[model samples]
Target: MLEDLDALSLRVQRAVQLAQGLQAERADLMAQIQQLQQRCQALQTQQAAERDEFARMSERLARHDLELQAAQKESAQARGTLEIQLHEQRAHAQSLQHSLQASQADCDRLRTAASGAQQQIELILERLPGAEA
Candidate 1:
């Protein structure tokens, strides 16, 4: 009976050691689960922020597209107006050139007639002076 008691005491000691080891393992597993939970929460927060930023950028892009379309329309209108004004200015310049040519021709004819009249008056003046004899 004394030998049986000694063997039972050894078995009890081994069981106590095994229970301590299992407690240590359980604490380590609990710490790991806590760390994993924190990492998952951080990832979720990051994803939410990224989603909000994407929405804002999408709205801004839509606004820019609208502005671009408006600018294009304005540019097209301005280009058409400029073309029309340029055509009118060209026509006006052509008409002015035609008028200038007509006026220059009339001036040339008048100058030729005035030179002939001056020569005839000089000849008459010379004859009158000789008749003074």
Candidate 2:
């Protein structure tokens, strides 16, 4: 009977030690769960902020694209106007060149006629007796 009592006491002691160890382990698990929950909340907040920033950037890109399109259209119109003006200027320059050529031809003919008149005047003077005297 004494031996039986001793063994039962030993079993009780071991059970109490095991219960304490399990309680310590549960406390550690609870602390780890709290830390994980906090980390998850922080990550969620960061994700939301990143999403908002991405949306803003997307809108800005769209606006920039629209502005670029408008600028390109204006540039194209300016280019067209410049091309038309250049064509007109080239045509005017061509007309002036033709007019200059015709004037040059008229000048050459007038010079030839003047030279012939001068030759005739010299012949008349040479034929006149005592003209130099």
Candidate 3:
């Protein structure tokens, strides 16, 4: 009976040691679970920040596209205005050239008529009595 009681006490001591080991393992597993949860939270925050940055970039790109389109439209309008001014200037220059040509022709005719009149006067004067003397 003494030997049986000693054996039973030894088995109880072994069961107590096993229970303590299981508790320690459970504590370690709980600490690991907490660390994983913290890591997941940090990732979610970073993803939110990245999404905000992407939205800002997309808005900036859209504004730049609108500006580019406006610039293109203004450039086209300016080009058209310049073309119209150039055509008008060319027409005015042609009209001035025509006026100058007509004036030059009138001057030539007047010079010819004056030269013939001078010749007739000289001849009539020579035919007058003692005009040569």
Candidate 4:
């Protein structure tokens, strides 16, 4: 009976020791799980922030695209207007050149007529009072 009692007591002590070791291992595992959960939450927050930044960048890119399109349209319109003005200026220059040519022709004709008239007047004066005297 004494031996049996000693064996029972030894068994009880080993069981208590085993239970205490298991409880300590469970506490360590719980701490590890809590740390992993916190890391996951931080990653989630970082991902959300990155997502928001990406959206803002996308919006900015869209606005820039719109601005570029508007600039291109305005440039095209300006080029068209400049082309029209250039054409008009060329036409006006041609018209002025024609007018200058016509005026030059008329001036030449009037100079020829005036020279002929002066020769006739000189011949008439020689035939009149200045004859042989």
Per-model C-alpha lDDT, please?
0.93, 0.96, 0.94, 0.96
Residue-level lDDT tens digits of model 1 in 77-121: 999999999999999999999999998998898888888889988
Candidate 1 Cα deviation (angstroms), residue 76: 2.2
| lDDT tens digits by residue: candidate 4, 80-112 | 999999999999999999999999999999899
Q: Return the top candidate by TM-score.
A: 2
- TM-score for each candidate, following the candidate numbering: 0.75, 0.79, 0.66, 0.75
Ranked candidates (lDDT, high to low): 2, 4, 3, 1
Q: Which residue pairs collide in model 1, if any?
A: none
Q: Give stretches of model 4 more than 4 Å off.
A: 1-17, 125-133
lDDT of 3 by residue, 10-124 (tens): 9988998988898899899999999999999999999999999999999999999999999999999999999999999999999999998999998899889899999999999
For candidate 3, report its TM-score: 0.66
lDDT of 2 by residue, 1-133 (tens): 9999999999988998998899999999999999999999999999999999999999999999999999999999999999999999999999999999999999999999999999999999988999875
Candidate 2 whole-model C-alpha lDDT, 0 to 1: 0.96
2 or 3: which has the higher lDDT?
2
What's the distance in Å from true for residue 12, model 4? 4.7
| Runs with alpha carbons beyond 4 Å of true place in candidate 3 | 1-22, 111-133
Q: What is the C-alpha RMSD, rounded to one decimal, of candidate 2? A: 2.5
